[model samples]
Target chain A: MIEIKGLSKKYGSTQALSDVDLQLRPGEIVGLFGPNGAGKTTLIKSIFGYIPYSGSITLDGEPVTRKNITRLSFATCEHSFFPNIDAKAHAQFYKDHFESFDEKRFNVLMEFFSLPKDKAIKHLSTGQQNQFEVIMALCQGADYILMDEPFAGNDIFNREDFYKVLLGMLGPDECVLLSTHLIEEVSGLINRAVLIDKGRIIGDVQLSELEESGRDLMDYIKKSFSYRSDRVFEALDQLVPEEERHEEMA
Target chain B: MKKWLSVLELHAAMRFKRVLLVLGTMIVLQMLSFWILGDQSNTQTFFQVLGKIKYGWIFALGFLAMYWALSWPLGRNETYSYTLQRLSVTERGSVWMKFIFNALCFVPLVIVQAGLILLMAKIFEAGKPFAGNAHGILIDLEKDGMLHALVSFSNPAQVIYRIVYILIATACATHMEVLFARKQTPILSFIPPVILLLINNIWYDEFHVAFAAAIIISVICMITALVRCRGKKPLRDILEQQEV
Candidate 1:
């Protein structure tokens, strides 16, 4: 389990996150939801130690450091790779540097995706590259996988297929913390939803609770983000001919 | 140890083609000059050629250290954060790995320059219109009262000082690359190396001061890079407020 307490991050004068507190338990898939500039990426990057923050964070009751970093895997919309090198070369690098690297799993995923081992990663199309990124994160032998916008560029078919593959591979002791705008698509997969707006979490609810109350998760989430139901109707009404409506009324 | 070697091997693979392209161009240009200037008109006299080559080497090494060597160490901007996260390497460790790999890559540049000198020596021994062999040219230059231009090459201690100076220059460049990756403005990112190099130039006549200055400057650059990489942020709270 990972625990976060009194976490805050500032980007210059802008407070990106403010006194954020959270916990992540194993064997659970948690969906992180937020709109643009909502501190979602900042939070992910903060946890991964990519940015500076004021916080106390621990994993399994020990402070996270370079030595224990391998226990967590991460992928983001901006694909991270050695563009000049091939998958096979990267696999070798990962194996050498990460004792937890599962080379066999890496090879299997590469084969499954038809991502050629010898071709430079830069040569792959954007969607395929995103797939490869997710593949690398999964095969890193991390118990916790944190992905931010990992499915942005992928087509629905590929995304669905990968979701199935990911579900099959996740062990009972593993956990995945995912952030995506495609909340409805992952509505079934995620056990809980955590919503953030203006650097503060507005909603944290279990899928079971929503299901028990017969609430549509998407509608509930849209409410938290302040989505108005009348906007579409009002815009369509503006398109009608005012003179024609007046004549009909007369 | 194995991880470091693996990174080295991977870096070599990534850069093999570009290195070949550059080195091959150098060799071909050298060989072409030798072939085209076969006992010909108004070309550089052998001593002049030798003088120019020595000067050329200094400029080439300096240029490579300043520019070509740091791009990889900076780690490409687009993929940097993601790569670090997935690979699970601390920023400091990643920078050091690339720095070492780049320093190692510099070995071939020296070897190729050495090879050019050997080829020139063999041609001179074979009675090409060369005035003297490689080392002999420096000896001849000193004999001809041309001491100022070649004084650093004239003594072993000065040669060692020159090597140390170049190391500091390159080390500063590598750290600058890290700062640049941090997205510092152009002038701020460039100040440290420029100041250090300026100090080296000012103290050039006083060898010990210059050497000590370079060492101190390089140490400062290294420390800044280390501190920047050792950010207070830890990896456990990765997504407290992140929107997917």
Candidate 2:
């Protein structure tokens, strides 16, 4: 279990995250949903110890620090691997430092992605680089894996396929916190959705409850970000005459 | 110990090919310069001809090697969060590992220099330059004595301090980049070396003092770089926003 309490961050004048509290538990796939500039990346990055924050974060009851940070891993869309080395060499690097690294899992993931082990990772297309980055995070054998916009470069089919593969391969003791703007794509996949906008989290919903309410997940999220619910309807009404609006409504 | 060595070896491996390519190029260029531009007409010994071209090549070598060392471990654009988090040691360990690897790369240059000097000496001995004075070029350096022009490899003492001094220069440049470039620290990062160089110039006498000065200054700069690296903001910020 990982816990964050009163986490806040600022970048110069911009408050990237504000008084945020979140928890990541074992066996849960938590979706971090937010609009553009919603501080989705900031929240998770702070939890990962990428930046300093006012609050405390703990991994399995221990305070987060350099030695214990390896227990949680981060995979981002922007390329991170050394461009000179192949995927195999990257795996070796992880294996060298982290005792929990699972070679078998990495091999399986590579074969599934059809990633050639010997070619330098820099030569891989952007989408493939994203896939490899996610693979490394998952196979790092950490208790919690955090991904930021990892599926952006990948095709929809590949993204869908990876979601299923991830669901199947995740150990019961491991968990994931994935941050992305593709709310609809992950709407059905994630168990719980945490929504943030303008540096603060506005909604936390168990998908099961949202589903039981028969409210569309995307609609619920859009409402959280909505200032005037009728604004769109009013604009459309003006764009189309009353007779046409009535006809469309009908 | 083993993990630390693994880091060094991996870093060395990543750069080994490029270093070899550069080493080969420098050798060919040096040989070409010797054949074409060497001061054969005016000087007697290989050392005098070599001295004319030495400073420029040394500056070039130091500058090139130092730039690479500054970006050692990884490039500016690349994120090290993944690598740093996985490391068994502190982030400071990353810098130390890079230092070892970058220092090791200097070894080949020294060996090649020694070989070139020995080969030149052999050529100079075959009645090649003087046809008169086999004692070799004591030309402008006669004040330093003819013995100073003796082939250096047979006397390792002649080359070791020079190698150490070059390594120190490279190390200082590297630490400056780590502080000024990577960490985005204040201009104070440039101070330590300047102060140390001043002190070193005052104490300049033999290999003993130069070696001591180099080791002491390199250690201090490494510590400063590491302290700044750890205490400073994570590199992810610049990498996140910059064109890289």
Q: Pick the candidate with the highest DockQ.
A: 1
- Model 1, span B1-244: residue lDDT tens: 6765665576567666666666766776666555554342343445555544443434253435434445433234445445554444555666677567656545455456556645664665456345555566545445422222224365786467546645665566557656555544323324434544444333334445545755887777777666666543322233333332
TM-score of each predicted structure versus truth: 0.81, 0.82
Error of 1 at B65 (Å): 7.2
Task: Give lDDT per model, in order.
Answer: 0.68, 0.69
Q: Give the DockQ-based CAPRI class for model 1.
A: acceptable
Query: Chain A alone, model 2, TM-score?
Result: 0.90
Q: Count the backbone clashes (under 3 Å) in each candidate.
A: 7, 1
Residues B1-244, model 2: lDDT tens digits: 7678777766666667677766777777767777677767776555566665552354255335544544444444456544664566666676677776666666555566556655655566554645324454333223232123222444576556556655665466547646544546434434433443443333324435545755677767766767756632456546345321
Model 2 regions more than 4 Å off = A227-250, B39-48, B51-59, B62-66, B69-76, B124-160, B163-167, B173-177, B180-220, B231-233, B236-244
Residue A210 of model 1 has an lDDT of 93
Question: Deviation in angstroms for A53 in model 1?
Answer: 2.3
